[model samples]
Every structure is written in C-alpha cells, then in structure tokens.
Target: MVSKVNDLDYFVAASEQEALILELNLIKRHHPRYNVRLKDDKTFPYLKIDLNEDWPRVHITRRLEEDGGRYFGPFASAKSVRQTLKLIKGIFPFRSCSKPITGTDTRACLDYDIGHCLAPCIGAVSQKEYAEVIKRVILFLEGKQERVVQQLKSKMNRAAEALDFERAVRLRDQIQAVEQVVEGQRIATTVKGEQDVIAFAGDKDQACVQVFFIRSGKLIGRESFLLQGTR
Candidate 1:
C-alpha cells in the first residue's frame, strides 16, 4: 500500500472531534480503496421525522436523505433504535398512523384507543399542537432532557391555569417519565461536559471502533464501526 501511494496530504483541525469528523468525511467522500468498508452506512438505522407530511411520524430509516426531514441517529442496530422509539412513544404518544390526514375521519384507530397516538385523523390534535409534540421529541432525542422538562412544566402550568386538570395531569405524568429516565441514566464520570469515548480493536487486516456519545455525564448513544486496510 505504501509503495502504491504517490503522495501524501493532510489538513489540521481545531480539535480532536473535528479531526475525527474530517477523517470520516474524507473516507465517505473519497471512498478510499483501503477504507471502503468503513463507509458503509447500512449497518445502522436513523430515526426520521418527515416534516413534509401534515402529520409527521417517527420511524426508523436506514437512509439519510436531505428531504427536509429531521433525523436523529445512526444507532448501533435496529433493536436499539426501536427501543429508543418505544421510549419516545411512551412519553410523547404522537400519531403513528400512515393514513392521509384530512382531519375529517369518522373514527380513530387502535393506536389512539391504546393511548399510542394523538389521533390527528379525527381532529384530536391540530397541526400546530402536533408540531409542539414533535419539537419536544426532537429536543429529547438531541439529549436535551432538561429543556423538554422545562417546556412540559410550562405547558402543564398553563393547562392547570386554564382549568384543564386532565391535560395537566397527563403532562405531569410525562414529566415524571422523563425525569425517571434521566435519573436512571445518571452516573459518575471523570469528564465534565459532552464527550465521545472511543475504543479500537484490530487484527492485521481489519479493525473495529466503538464510540460512546456522552452528554452531561450520561451515555446518550453508542455505535461501532468496522474498517479495513490495517494490513
């Protein structure tokens, strides 16, 4: 490999994270013969929320497209992505149906009956109201639980002030759920802020890398990647 290479060039990055980004971007863009294995994105899935639709639904998608949709992750596996989706659904309980949203449907689906959806099909929630839910989902997925909690609290207070005790109670339940998850993830860490912990293992011809994304001393996500050209 060294004999085949004619020249070498490099760029300096401002930080270690920036350097890693540059390396991955270059590998993805150029698809170097030796590092081609690392460029494969099919090994993981991302959480996509297509903003193009009137009622955006959260789902797992392998491809990351630039279609104005908000994407959350390249999770380690489908199972992990599904687990996260389940948690989000339990808390937010937005609409998960595929039917066109005309807001004139006669009946709600089973998901709405089971408390898994807001049932926007029958005008259970207006678009503006549903957008608020999506905003919280995005914040929660971005590891901004504190912001979500604050927003929930504010909404709950407003609901209470409006004499809507039922809605306020539901918001209270959501707040407790979010707090429980956050508390369960709390642990000791030597690092002070957001940090990415990376580990590598390899043989002569191939290698694997594991990365843990930590925020506020909690592990937010994990991923592993395989690479070639170690020979």
Candidate 2:
C-alpha cells in the first residue's frame, strides 16, 4: 500500500476509457507502491520512433501519447532496451534528434562525421535514403531479421554496382549486425492466426507477463510487464 503524500495531482479525461489509459501510463511510469512493480525498481523503456516529424528519430521513453509516432517495447527492463538501442544505432544511421530538419547548416554534426547518423538535417543524405535506413531499423525492431538482411544485401549489391564501395561496406556491416544482434527467440505457442498472444511466468515473489504480437505466421514484436505481488 502507498502512504499518503503531502501533495497530489489529478488529470482530466473526456471519457472513462481515456481516463483509464491515462492512469495506466501514469502508473506504469511512476510504479507507485500500490501498483504493480517491475524488477530493478524501474519502469520499462519504450522504443519511440517519432513518425510525426519530418525527420524521424528513435527515442527511448516511458510515456505514450496520442501522437502519430510509432512505439515499441515495454521491454523486460531498461537495461535490455539500452542494449537493443546500442545495437540499433550500430547498424542503422537513423537520427537521434527531436529537432526539425533544415539543410541550411554548412557542416554536418559530429554524429554524421562518425557515421552514427546519415545527416538528413544537413543535406548530406536525402530523405529517401534516410528513410530506407529507418525502414531497416523498424524491420529489426519488428523481429524481421531475415527480411532486413535480404534488403540490405540487395542495397549493397546496388551500391557496389554504382561503384560506391564505401556505402556497400556499410550495408554489409549492417547486415552482419542484424544477424549478430537478433538471436534465437523460440515460439512458445502453437500455430495460430494473427493475434496478440500472452504468456506469464514467475514464482511467488514476482511475475512477468509477456505479450507477443504475431501476424502472418511471424512474431512481429513483444511487450513485457512485470508484477511484484505474489500469487
């Protein structure tokens, strides 16, 4: 049970459903003592790809809003999210900024110089090219490793044919990173149509609820929730 606080805040929603969602996101972020808790005493991290912006950037956040951006995760832990993000940045040169892209700058940022970003903001890379990188990242997060690898291989071949050996080498590295990062995640359920499948596992002290989204006979993504209460 949570102890009484000296101050409190209230939120207003137009409907009960909206109110419920607001409460859930709040509790998920705060993890109040009276609410379900996660391991490490921290909230899960969400992989937020802000699609609403002209130049999208992948951000890790705990809050979910009504914005048009796409989100993934409620991962097992924040650490896992960080690891996944490191792997993503290693392979995909997606921008990590929230600012609007303007190509007026004379020079690209350090991220572009180091090859962490494709520098769409500074006109070093076209929107179409940057979008292709983001697409590979989205595929990676969606657990479509084989598809991403094939796409990268095709892109590499095209770059090589164009005599862009540098770009071809980068694509080859991205393909290798995809293969190395995406490991064996076995299917836990029987064959079924498109659905959101959930499974739970834990002992008396804690519990974990893992939800797997499957479509077209493939696991698209997964979200995990941890509970501290006993059975």
Candidate 3:
C-alpha cells in the first residue's frame, strides 16, 4: 500500500507476493506516468555533420540517431551555438546546402560574397578536399586542440612558402581563433573542470541567491535571482 504523509509518499509491502500484487495493480490502475515508462520526447540541440557522405552538410538538430554522421553539443544557449556554427562556417566552409553538390548549376550565396562560406554550394571545392577540411573541424571540436593547431601551423607555413601572404595571414587568424576557444574553455571551468556553480536560499514567501562564475581562478561574473510565491 502507498499513502501520503507530511507531503511525502510512502509505500509498504508485507511480503514479496504482496509487493508484486501492489506493483501490478499500480501499473494497471493508477498508471502513474513516472512508473509506466520513460519518456524520450525531449532532447537538447546538437550540431550534426554528415562527414562520410559525398557532399557533407552541417545541420542544427536535436535528434541522436546512428546515421553514419558526427554529432556535437548539448550547448546551454541556442544563440551561442548558432554563433559558434557561424564562426565555423566562416572558416571551414564544408557545405550547408540540403541538395547534393552534383551538377546542380549552383550559385554562391551571400555567405560567400561576405567571406563567410567557401561556396562549396557552387562546386568551388571537390568532395575529397572538402572532406579533409571537415575532418580538421571534427578534430578541433573533439578537443584535439594540439592536432588542429599543428595542422594550421603547417598550412600557414606552406602558404608562406608558396608566397601566398594573404592566405598565410588568413590561416594565422584561424589558428588564433581556435586558440582563443581553448583558452576560453579553460577559463570557464574551475580547476576541477566544473563549468558553473549554483546556490539558492528561500523562505515561505520568497527566495533568492547569487551565482558566481569563477573562471581561471578568478571571479569573472555573478547573477542574482528572485522567486515569488503564488499564493
């Protein structure tokens, strides 16, 4: 039998058979949502990339299925996720179109004209070469920071050797951006790698607390919250 006492629910069974009977009846009658089954409807947003396909594309989604693609993120903020994706699309330009890049008579989007996308939508980059660039992005997102930094350094060196100062400068800037992300991650986490801290205080009528963000051994920011009673 299950009963409520002091706002808490308690269940008691005298014997195994009785427990089984109680459980079966609970499942059949009350059918309490939590006791019936687990829900799979909610999920956090993630960035999905089809790296193995002929013409890869990056998409923002909330599903997790094994479709021979790569997935990243359970980012706390949609805006931050979008901004990071924009930054990546700017430098990497792996394809963002829905259609295959076959002989589609494609034209460059605004991203290309604004120097954000590499215009893979227009067949500017072949599948094999674009796959290589996507691989670099995957490595960078997978926390293989040194690998990406080394690869960018090599690219910058090659561009400099080939007397392409403009390309070399761009590569240098990309490397710096990657470094900045790593540094930011380090600063966002505590020494134990915990990202944020939360505290709360409350009474019958109201509640409030201040949250402090300690980044890289420094208190960087804080926020306070207040809650109201309904009745």
The whole-model lDDT of each prediction reads 0.85, 0.77, 0.68
Tens digit of per-residue lDDT, candidate 1, span 140-167:
9988898999999999999999999988
Summed over model 1, clashes come to: 0
In model 2, pairs of residues that clash are: none
Root-mean-square deviation (CA) per prediction: 4.6, 7.3, 9.2
lDDT of 3 by residue, 155-181 (tens): 899999999997788779878887776
Error (Å) of candidate 3 at residue 150 is 1.7
Which candidate's TM-score is highest? Answer: 1
lDDT for 107 (candidate 3): 77
**Clash count list over all predictions:** 0, 0, 0
Model 2 weakest lDDT span, ten residues long: 35-44
Candidates, ranked, TM-score: 1, 2, 3
lDDT for 110 (candidate 1): 88
TM-score of each: 0.78, 0.65, 0.63
Better of 2 and 3 by TM-score: 2
